[model samples]
Target: NAGVTQTPKFRVLKTGQSMTLLCAQDMNHEYMYWYRQDPGMGLRLIHYSVGEGTTAKGEVPDGYNVSRLKKQNFLLGLESAAPSQTSVYFCASSYSWPPGDREGTEAFFGQGTRLTVV
Candidate 1:
């Protein structure tokens, strides 16, 4: 089973261009998140959804939006790409928040989506 899958593993976008990254999981997780990884900065949360049809802003929400229309799918959209938006994006899903030693709390991540905005 594909734990988590991200579409378009790599992409190069010009300024003002728009694109959407898709994340899908088959683990039946209830929490999903979008994060970006830059050279110096570690993972920075972009957005997250606790369940289907629910989404919330994260650390860096500007220039990006996300939606969880289905229980197993999450989409991150860039309205207008920017240079600073260039980064490796990751999608993760977990069965619980504040992950602990509890079963199913461990997050499963997708390979990753490398995005470059020029």
Candidate 2:
């Protein structure tokens, strides 16, 4: 099974265009998150889903939207592409880590999708 898969490993969009990046995970993690990475900065959460049919905005949810239609799929959409929005996007899934287990707190992340808007 593909643990976590992201579609269109790379993409380039002209400013004002729109596109969706898909994230699929085989593991049934209770929570799923989308994040974007810029040079020198760490991953910043964009949106997240607690379960199928539920979605919420995150730290950087401003130019983007997300939907979790199924337990295994999370979709991130860019309504209108902008140069400021260009970054490496990542999808990650995680189970609730037990309070005392350090090793179990780590999350599983997809390879990432590199997006460029100009």
Clashes found in each candidate (C-alpha, N, C closer than 3 A):
0, 0
What is the C-alpha lDDT profile of model 2 across 1-118, one tens digit per residue?
A: 6878999899999999999999998877767899999989899999998889999989999999999989899999999999999899999987654322466545789999999998
Among the numbered candidates, top lDDT falls to 1
State candidate 2's TM-score.
Answer: 0.91
- Which portions of model 1 miss their true places by more than 4 Å? none
Model 2, CA-based lDDT:
0.89
Q: What TM-score should be assigned to candidate 1? A: 0.96
Residue 40 lDDT (model 1): 83
lDDT of 1 by residue, 1-118 (tens): 9899999899999999999999999989999999999888899999999999999999999999999989999999999999999999999999888755597689999999999988
Off by over 4 Å in 2: 97-105
Local distance difference test scores for all models = 0.94, 0.89
User: What range of 10 consecutive residues in model 2 has the weakest lDDT sum?
Assistant: 96-105
TM-score of each: 0.96, 0.91
